[model samples]
Target chain A: MVRVALYTLLGVMSVVMVAPLVYMVSLSLQTEAETLSAQAVLWPENPQWGNYAELFVKAPFGDFIVNSFVVAGGITLAHLLFDPLVGYVFAKFRFPLRNTLFVALLATLMVPFFVRMIPLYVLMAQLGWLNTFQGLITPFLMDAFGIFLMRQFIQPIPDDLISAARVDGASEFTIYRKIILPQTKPALAVLGLFTFVFQWNEFLWPLVATTTPEMRTIPVGLTLFNQEYFTLWHLTAAGSVILFVPTAILFLVSQRYFVRGITLTGLR
Target chain B: MSLSARYARTAYLFLLPALVFFTAFFYVPIANVIATSLHTGPQADVFAGLSNYADALADPSVRHSFLVTLGFSGGVVAGSLVFGLLLALVLDQPLKGRVTFRAMLLVPYLTSVAIVGLLWRNILDPQLGILNRLGLDQQWLNEHPLATIVGVTLWQTVGYTMVLFLAGLQGIPETYQEAARIDGASAWQRFWRITLPLLAPTTLFVSVMAVISGLQAFGQAYIITNGGPGDATDLSVFHIYATAFKTRDFGYSSAQSVLLLVVIVLFTLMQLRAGKRGEVTY
Candidate 1:
């Protein structure tokens, strides 16, 4: 009886957690009139999978998705390269001021990006990099969070493994490339996914950075879509699905990493 | 190649990229923000002392914004503490298919805030929303704006806090619970004495993250209420964005942002101090 009650509780909680997403899909398939009707409709008579395609036409969402992928992917790859290298330096090397430097980086983590927005925007505008991919990609190509998380993972790697490589005349670069990189794959995935998802959902920065529709990211584009077509809930829901799918797929494939990442860093 | 060699030159090589990034992106922007915060003229070239900050502090809008953010963060921390812990305790049971349930719960945390905000806006739409048709026909966004923000945010992030708590719960020695039980302690007593105390660090961590994220909230304000029917949801970040971009008052915006950062750092330090007091060494 207790077991049945437990299952029932979890089952209800799961529905609460998932109902919005399920409703989004259902709403996306409905007609505009059906969506705005006084009575709520859980299912549409006709499923407009065509709404997904029409979303592409209503806006350059295809380009926006590609922009999101490029910018987010570019930032993730940069973090994967530099963060671990930095983490290895902090983890293995006993440099003077190492702790000070590490703490300095961590301190920046406390300073939210919004605090730096005005000047960062002006700085970009000064460089005439506004509305450009480089403007969106370059500034955040590195982050302190990745370095912090990577250091946590790399600290547990055995010292003797690196020592063995160094005794074999392996340069520091090769040791980091071959030993630390492979060992920290789990950390890398965690960092990469969090950074990618964070950047993909990034709205304010992209909205501030890119003025042209050509450079809009999915989140920014979708916000504009909702604003312009406030009554068109079906179309807006379709756009939400498009914005949501890649992250959903990522979570499904790496469910363990997302949970582990939260426990590891509580990163958002 | 000796491990004892003092300060390897190659270590700097590994750190060079990060150092460059911090200097250019992090440190420089910080310097620029502070410098801009000190100026107040129309062109913003004229140097003004603390007047911009003084002006911002005396402004009712700024004060209201900070209060709204405080209420929002407080609600989020309180809600997450209660519901998130409850969910964690439930999931910690040896129930069947809990992994799948855990995954389902975490989907919102994995989702974008923009999407989450828009979804809630649709659900709670006054005229044609599902909730109203289902009898929650109140003016949700207008009448109870902060609670509405808290509700959606908890819906999105309770899973995150639950998972953290679950990790903390799993880390506790099982023997402790068993020992308490053997001593004839009731399940509730054991939870109150043993489990909750051990979960302090995780609880602190969750509160700190939730508060900091809450104070800097923007997407919900921008998308859902546009800072609201009458500035009820005018959160700090949202207000700062408007003061900077919409009002074109960069000097004042920078001042407000600096103030917001000080508030975040202060809250974090206080929590860390309290966390240290509550920390259990065992």
Candidate 2:
């Protein structure tokens, strides 16, 4: 009886967790009249396909999607290259100030990104990078979290492999490239997913930094769409569904990495 | 290669980019903000002692914003953790066909916070929402908007917290539970004295992550409420954005940011202390 009750509870809670998503998908496909009907439709009677088309026609969502991809992709690539190299050095090499630098990086993690907003914005404005992809991606491309993630993963790799590569007259860069980088696919997949999802959903910096519609990411763009078409819930839902697709696909493909990343990060 | 020279060169090579980027992008900008906050007038050269801090302290909006921000964050942390742990415990049960359920629960964590905010705003829409259609006619936005926003945040993050908890639960040794059962402990007692205590480290880690993430919250409020219905959800970060860009009071905004950072640091310190206390428990 207790076992049966436990299953029932989990079954119910899981439904509650997923109901909003299901409802959003359902509402996106429902006609305005049907959506606003006195009785809610759990499943749409007639799924409207035009709402998805109207997302692009009615709003600047296509540009938003492109902007999201570019910013997220740029940040992920930068982190992958920069963090791993730094992490590899931190893990393998023991030098003066090594401990200091590592501590400084970890300390940097504690300082809230909120603290630097005003100064960063002013700096961006001064550099004429505001409302540009460079401004959106540059500051965020290399982060403490990525470095920390890379450091945690790289610390586990054996030293003898790098030593063997070094004995073969390989330069430090070559050792990092050939020896360390290849072994980091799993970590990279995890970090890449995180960075991509984070940047794709990033709203504040994009909203403040980008004045032009062309540079707006999907989240900020979706907000503008919400404000512009407050009356059109169907269209808004459709646009949200569109924004969700890439992230959902990425998560599905990288589920194991996501699971491992979350677990290891928590373990620390 | 000698140890000293090879170490020096390799260290410099490894640290170059991260140090440059970190200093320029993060530390220097923060330092500039502090300097800017102290400066006065258009030239921003003359130091005005403690004036910006005084002004920020006196501002009712900042104070109110701090209170509201605390309330919202506290609600999210509590809600997410409780719901998440509950779901985690359920999912951790030895049951048939649990894998599919686990995947379904994780979908929300995978969804973008932006989409989650937008989805919930409409999900709780006053007139035409499915919630209203189901005869729950309380005005989620106007009447109890704060709770509504908190509910949305909890829904979105519960999955994430649950996954962490699930991992933590799995890490608990089976022998401990067996020993407890052999000693005549009931299941609930075993969970309370054994499982919960063993899970302290995970709980501490999750709590710290939750608190820090909660303190820096931006996307959800910006998307859902836009700190709306007359500034009910005017969180500190949102206020900082408004002050810097909308009002163009960069100096004042910097002060606000400092104050916000101090609050987060204090919270982090408290969590670290609590985590230490838990370490003693084991």
Candidate 3:
């Protein structure tokens, strides 16, 4: 009886959580009429695969998807390129103000984006980066959390590997390239995956950074689609499905890392 | 140079690029925001000290938005947390399909906030929502704007807090609970006497995160109601966004930004304080 009650509770919570997603997909595939009618249309009578294609014709949704990928992918790749390099230094190197610098990074990590968004916007405007991909991507390219994550992963690397390489006259840069880079690939991947998903779901910065329709990422772009075509629930759901797909797939594949990502960084 | 000095040199060399980005992206802009808050004008060229903050504090909409935000955050933090702890406790019990259930629960959180907001907007629409046709009818978003968004956010975020709590629950050794069970303690007693005390650190961490994120919530307020039917759901960030973008009042917005920053930073300090206290004796 106790076990039954527990499963029932889990069942209800899971269904509650999963139901909206199911409804979203189902709603996406319905005809506009089905969505509009007073009666509920839980499933499309015939899945309107055309709504997906319709989004592109109605707007530059193809551009929105590409922009989402490019910005998210750009930020992820940038983190991959830079985070480990900085993380490696902080993890292994003994430098002046190193602890202070890392602590400062952590402090900045705690500073929510909402706090700096206005000044950052003003700064972006000053630089004429508004409505540009760089404007959307640059500020996020290297965050303190990425560096911190990489540092935690890199800290465990045995010092002997670097020492051994140095004994053979490997330059410090060479040691980083030869020894540390390969060793930190998993950390790099985790950071990359987390950054990509996090950035992809990102609404506020992209919403602030990109004013033009073409520059908007999926989330921002979809909001406009949602507002403009609020009557056509099917099309709205279609736009939503586009925004939701990549993230759902990524989260399932790397569920563990995503958990660790949040638990460690307290970021989504 | 000494070897240690040389190592430091190389470390700084490697660190140079990041420090530049940090300064350019993180520190400089942050410092500039605080600096921006201190000034005023169309050009933001005037050195008007504290007046913008005074204006921001006195403005009724600003006051309303802040209170709404506090209420929203309080609801989300408290509700999601209690539900999260309960769910985590349930999942902690030995059960079948627990792993699958855990992963399935995170779907809402895994999806983007904008999309989640839109999804529920359709489902909870007053005119023709599915729930209405299904006989569970209410003007959810219209009448209870704050509660509706809070409910949506709780639905989305409870999974995240659950995972944190689950990790905390697992960290606890089986011996203590087992001992409590043998001493004729009910499950409730074991939970109160043993589980709750051991889970303090996780509770602190989760509460701080919930509070910080709660205070910073924007996408829902932005996407769901556009800060709502009246100024009902105008979250602080949305209000800040409006002050900066809509009204072109950077000075006022930046002042509010600093104030919000103070709240986030205080909660962060609290988190940081308890961060070192995670070690618990059996």
Candidate 4:
């Protein structure tokens, strides 16, 4: 009896959780008249695949997707490369001011991005980087969280592995490349996925940084699309789906790592 | 050369990129924000100490924005915790489809906030919303705007909090519950005596995170209502954005941003105090 109650509760909660996404897709499939009709249906009688096609035609949505990929991809690549390098140093190397530097990075994590927004915008504007990809991508290229995550993951590798490599006359960079890099692949994956999803879904900074439609990322572009075409629910839903589906796929493909990433960073 | 010196040099080489980036992007900008907050004008060269802060504090809109921010954060934190803990407990059961349910719930979290705002805005539209068709005629975005924003934020965030709680729940050893069960403790008694006490740390962490994110909420208000219907849903961050970007009040916005930082720091300190007072050795 208890088991039945639990399943039923879970079933209702799952529907409530998933209803918006279902509604989004369903609304996207409806014609404009059907969408604005007096009676709203969960599923449209006639599926309108044309809404998806209309998204590309109505806006430079294809460019927005490309921009999203490029920005997210660039940030992820930078994090994968730089964060692990710094993490490896903090993990394996006994260096001057290492602990202090690590603490400083952790402290930076506490300073919310909003505090720096005005000045960062000014700096970007001064550098003539406003509306540019570099403006959107540069400040976020390497974050304190990524470095911290990489350090925790890299600390577990045995010291002897690095010692042996050094004794064989391997350089620090080579050791990082050959031994540490391969060992830290799982951490790298987690950091990479986290950065990618974050950058892809990032809205405020991109919205603030980029002004032109062409420079806008998927989320920003879709929002602008909504603001302009507020009444067209079908097109707006389609645009949201276009912006959302890629990240959803990424999350599903690496659901385990995504959850682990949240739990690991969440505690800190 | 000493071994330590060699290691230090190599480490410095590795650290160069991060240090440079942090200096250029993080440290300098923060210093600039503080420096600018005390000054006047777009160029911000003229010194006008505390004036911007005074203006920001005295402004009715700013005061209203802070109140709305508090209400919104409080609602989100409460809603997420209550609902999230319940969902976590339900999913913790050895049900056959728990994994599938958990994954399905996480879709909202994976979706972007901007998209969430757009989707919810459509769903809550008074004239054309499906909810209206179901006999609810309230204007969600316009009427009870704070509740609407909080509900949308809860939708996007509760799954994440659930995942965190689930991890915490799983970390708890089964032996304690089993021992309580063997001692003739009812399920409610076991939960109240054993589980609730143990879950305190996770609860604190989740609430702190929710509060921090809630205070910083912007996209929902900006996207859904544009802080509209007479500033009903204007939040601190969105207010700051308007002051700085829309109204071209950099100094004032910087002051507001400083105040926000202060609010966040106080919350963090409170969490530290709570964590210290409620330190569970287990």
Which candidate wins on TM-score?
4
Across A38-62, the per-residue lDDT of candidate 3 in tens digits comes to 7888887799999999989987899
Q: Which residue pairs collide in model 1, if any? A: none
TM-score of each: 0.96, 0.95, 0.96, 0.98
> Which pairs clash inside model 3?
none
- Report lDDT per candidate: 0.88, 0.82, 0.87, 0.89
DockQ of candidate model 4:
0.82
Candidate 1 CA-lDDT value: 0.88
Order of candidates by DockQ, top first?
4, 3, 2, 1
Q: Per-residue CA lDDT of candidate 3, range B235-258, in tens?
A: 999999988888888888999989
Ranked by TM-score, the better of candidates 3 and 4 is 4
Candidate order, lDDT descending:
4, 1, 3, 2
Cα lDDT over the full model 4: 0.89
- In model 4, pairs of residues that clash are none
Q: List fnat per candidate, in order.
A: 0.77, 0.76, 0.82, 0.84
Model 3 misplacement above 4 A: A266-268, B270-280
Candidate 4 C-alpha lDDT tens digits along A192-260: 888888889999999899989999998999999888987988998998888888888888789899888
Residue B23 of model 2, lDDT score: 95
Instruction: Give per-residue lDDT, candidate 3, residue B112.
Output: 87
Measured with C-alpha atoms, the lDDT of residue B195 in candidate 2 is 81
- The better-scoring model by TM-score among 1 and 2 is 1
